[model samples]
Target: MKAAKAPQAPEPTGDPAERLRELKAGLARAAALGGHPPPSLIAVSKTVPAEAIRPLIGAGHRLFGENRVQEAEAKWPPLLAETPGLELHLVGQLQSNKAEAAVRRFDAIHSLDRASLVTALARAIDRTGRHPLLFVQLNLGREPQKGGVAPEGLEDLLKDARNAGLAIFGLMTVPPAAKEPAPYFALLRKLARRHGLAGLSMGMSSDWDIAASLGATHVRIGSALFGPRG
Candidate 1:
């Protein structure tokens, strides 16, 4: 007998609001398939300008992800000031020197992958009196060029984060490109379970449904919501 196939998620089409609806429905269906709660969607607004993001914000999308500290600082502050309850997330590599700036601006940091970063964030948190939710990024594919901590070094990083007073809320991973992502998502889920971490920040426009079904708590979506960048 042929095995049952997983449901394919619908492609997000139309305007931003309609796209958001489709994406949310797809995520809900994926969550049902996995027997887990629907994951939070972080509409990745990295290079998209404020004009483009306003519609989603008007449609009640409060969580957004940015790649750089400078860009976020330039774009979000006024928008966030006008729209209360908006949560900005830093979804790219964060330099230790920018820890203070990151702590000040973002609501969650998804790239806490090294000892120096942990120490820097800890000091920044203490100095600013702000505590953003943190995620330990794991280099599941063991890519040298990536920003994630190696699987073998994750425990040590976690230990350092904890000792430095940073509360690690989850694990995040970017699967190797040009390949299937489900296995990586499953591996991340297993790693989180082993470490007693509750959140998994995996998935993107291409494989978010797979990530959701495998137990992702936060899915970072860019093109699906905002269209392709220039």
Candidate 2:
């Protein structure tokens, strides 16, 4: 009897390609719906294989959002070295302890929700001389479990961040899973307008079009791009 053939891993197909196509379609739809399309597409590759992402890079998708610092540390350096345009953004709840590593590696950070974390990141910035763009997260959902500065507190945070020399690019937030996220996305946009800020990082795989209509400058999509994380 022939020896059993080694088990083969399934081949990946239309992943990043399909993802880009979907993203473009989404952008078009969003543009047709209301306001201008976002300028940045943050591919939220939380658990997806890095191999799949390179195809996206080849397809002209260079900005990626990693939620965890350790994973980014593991995946970003080589890809960035190989593809110079690659931009790695941090898009999850960040710990103060990780600020040092975060400031050094990420091109932008999307979770500046508290003074303590901001202080930590500022200190890290001073030590590393690396100041990644900052997005002050707002508690749009007002969810008890979520992490963001209460919307009422946004100005003070933005003011301090500006004074510290940290680039206050814009703001971000996660709407409660219970209702439509459009309101929250819109709220962020309105707040950005109020503060005269430039970027708005909202929306995800499911709600980006609404986010775009509401003036999101950056949309972080994961599942739609990677076909649901394993």
Q: Pick the candidate with the highest TM-score.
A: 1
Tell me the alpha-carbon RMSD of every candidate: 3.5, 9.4
lDDT by residue for model 1 over 7-120, one digit each (tens)?
Answer: 334578999999999999999999899999999999999889999999999998999999999999999988998999999999999999999999999999999999999999
Candidate 2 residue-wise lDDT, 176-218, digit = tens: 7657776677788889999988988987776777777677788
Clashes of each: 0, 0
Clashing pairs in 1: none
lDDT of 1: 0.92
Cα-based lDDT for every prediction: 0.92, 0.81
TM-score, model 2 to reference: 0.89
Q: Residue 159 deviation, candidate 2, in Å?
A: 3.0
Off by over 4 Å in 2: 1-14
Candidate topping lDDT: 1
